[model samples]
Target: MSGSFYKVECPDCENEQVVFGKASTEVACAVCGTTLARPTGGNADIEGDVLETVEAR
Candidate 1:
């Protein structure tokens, strides 16, 4: 099954960006360069607010 995409809001800047749920590497905010998610060997550990979840089609 395909993984999901998350709409994350940076806690520091409130910048919104799409991040892979199973991201292997660190996912950073585009505007503020804040860590949005980090690899956890499974699903990434989301560091900010998850505004939405988009399932892969």
Candidate 2:
């Protein structure tokens, strides 16, 4: 089975970028020049909501 799509937020600029495929390292931000951990970044609002749902339950 394949791992679920995961998101990663930029720690520096708080920018978001989607990771459409498998795991990767050193994915750069499309807007900024920051080297992010993962390329899949859920927008701040979406990120928050997902977290909320998990926490609520």
Candidate 3:
């Protein structure tokens, strides 16, 4: 599947961030420095609360 953007809420500080669905690197929360997603072979492993899936415009 193609990569997409997702709005994620940090579990630690409730900070929101947009992250790539298929990110090849670790994604961290900008406010709290918490890990949000990890790189897998396919889709990224999401660790934060997913708010929504953003559509590419």
Extract clashing residue pairs from model 2: 8-40
Predictions in order: lDDT: 0.91, 0.41, 0.91
Give candidate 1's error at residue 9 in angstroms: 0.5
Instruction: Superpose all Cα atoms of candidate 3 onto the true structure and report the RMSD in Å to 1 decimal.
Output: 1.9
Better of 2 and 3 by lDDT: 3
Q: What lDDT score is found at residue 38 in candidate 1?
A: 99
**Candidate 1 error regions (>4 Å):** none
Candidate 1 — which pairs collide? none
- Per-residue CA lDDT of candidate 2, range 27-54, in tens? 5667776654443433222221111121
Question: Each prediction's TM-score against the native?
Answer: 0.90, 0.41, 0.90
